[model samples]
Target: MAVLRTLLGQALRTTRLSQERTLREVSSAARVSLGYLSEVERGQKEASSELLASICRALGVRLSDVLRDVSETLSVIEPEPAPVLVPVAVPAMAGPGTTAAELRSVRRPVRDVVAAA
Candidate 1:
């Protein structure tokens, strides 16, 4: 997975370009330091939730929308994890027979057979 820095940087760059907003304008609107916002936009630093919220507001987008866009982008780039494996044990039982030897048979897998009286 791409680090949050890279992720946010990509998001910031894309958002800024799409909205035709400069980094300086966005930083002021988001009430963050210009240098800090620049680092975030370059993915050099991780932005806090508050900072992200402010940026989202500046971009005129909701946090959920930003996350959804990120999710879709990540799905396109990331490989799926392997499926989990689980083990199941089947039951074992003695075989049926008329004679003592058959009755005393060791435990074995059940077999489908017709019973006789």
Candidate 2:
């Protein structure tokens, strides 16, 4: 599973680093302890929504922008869905013990499959 906090922390750190700012500078501007800010940036601590907003403000960025970047990053890191396996009832004419490979292929989108049932 993708860790939201870790992604959020990475986004925050990337933004800060891109601005060529130090942890001390941002922490001071955000009115948070340097240690806590460091922890947040390192993904060692999960920051509250309010703290995230404050950090964004200190970094001169919008919270939405950071979240958008994180969302994009997560989309790339998220795993693709596993292939679905559905048993197909073979006709008596086919054989008594037909293998899966011999079954009729039903390739449908997930929504289509749901709607079909």
Off by over 4 Å in 1: 86-117
Best model per TM-score: 2
For residues 1-117, write the lDDT of model 1, one tens digit per residue. 776568767887798889888888998999988898889888898888888889999989887887788877888888877653332232244335355554434323233111211
**Alpha-carbon deviation at 34 in model 2, angstroms:** 0.6
**Tens digits of lDDT, candidate 2, 1-117:** 668988888889999999999999999999999999999988889999999999999999999999999999999989988766555444556666766556655444565566777
Q: Candidate 2 at 79: error in angstroms?
A: 0.9
List of clashing residue pairs for candidate 1: none
Model 1 gets an lDDT of 0.74
User: Over 4 Å off in model 2, which ranges?
Assistant: 83-110, 113-117
Per-prediction TM-score to the true structure, in the order listed: 0.67, 0.70
